[model samples]
Target: MQNLQGKSIAILATNGFEQSELEVPRDKLRGAGATVHVISLEPGRIKGWDKDDWGNPVDVDRTLDSVSADDYDAIVLPGGQINPDLLRVEQKALDFISKFWSDNKTVAAICHAPWLLVETGIAKGRKMTSYPSVKTDVINAGAHWQDSPVVTDQGLVTSRNPGDLDAFCEKIAEEIKEGRHERRAA
Candidate 1:
């Protein structure tokens, strides 16, 4: 495990996030010694979607309006059918993600969350992967889509789904530890 001590990471998410996609990475990252913050659209607790139904609620440490991308070394976007669906439509959410790209910070997404990357115009020309259902959307966004457990390009890390959480989390930590990447204009 990479030593992420003193590193601050933000998990951007909201209600309907895949239970495992969000929790597993958040817990694993924190366990790796990174300071993790659960950032959402609003304050209070956000509910999660388990396999087929609603699961536990995670506390929100900060709201989107309250923080800037500069505050964290990396950002994570966890996917669920509903979560990314909701986030992709929010201008604030999209803008927040764009900042991460402009700053060259590690941007990680899993499952359907890659949709957020598309909406922010960050998908184009990058190698990425997401939930099978999101393949069309990613490719349509001009990304070089791949069928893999995890795919990374220029500090952006993406994974297929919950089953790939282990690789996803590990890659996220590795990217953050590598520090900022020199990325081309998006």
Candidate 2:
């Protein structure tokens, strides 16, 4: 694992997030020595969705309005059907994600979280992957969708689903270490 000391990473999520999708990366990144913050739409804790039911609550490190893209080296979006569905419709969420892409910072999304990429207009022309059900949406947004554990274009990293968590988290650390990329703005 890379030594991520001094690196700051933001895990943007909210209630209904896939439990493992959010927990795994947050734990992995923090274990690698990066400061990980769980930023939600509101303060306090947010509940997660497990395979079929509600999961444990994760404490919120900060609310979306309280943080800026400039404070972190990378941003991660954890996917759950409900999580992305809710976030994609929030203009605030969309704009926050767009800022990361526009700044060329590492923008990582796993599973259905890629929906945010499409909404933020950053999926166009990028080779990425997401949950099987999100394939059509990604393609419609002009992305070259692939059926792989993980795919990366520029600083954007994506994974198919929970099965790809290992690769997803590893790639996130790698991308953060690579620093900002020189890519077309969203």
Q: List the residue pairs that clash in candidate 1.
A: none
At residue 92, candidate 2 shows an lDDT of 84
Residue pairs whose backbone atoms clash in candidate 2: none
Reference-based TM-score of each model: 0.98, 0.97
Give per-residue CA lDDT, model 2, range 1-186, as digits (tens): 688999999999989999999999999999999999999999999999998999999999999999998899999999999998999998888888898888889999999999999988899999999999999999999999999999989999999999989999999889889989999643
lDDT of 1 by residue, 28-108 (tens): 999999999999999999999998999999999999999999999999999999999999999999998999989999999
lDDT of 2: 0.93
lDDT to native, each model: 0.94, 0.93
The TM-score measured for candidate 2 stands at 0.97
What value does the lDDT take at residue 3 in candidate 1? Answer: 85
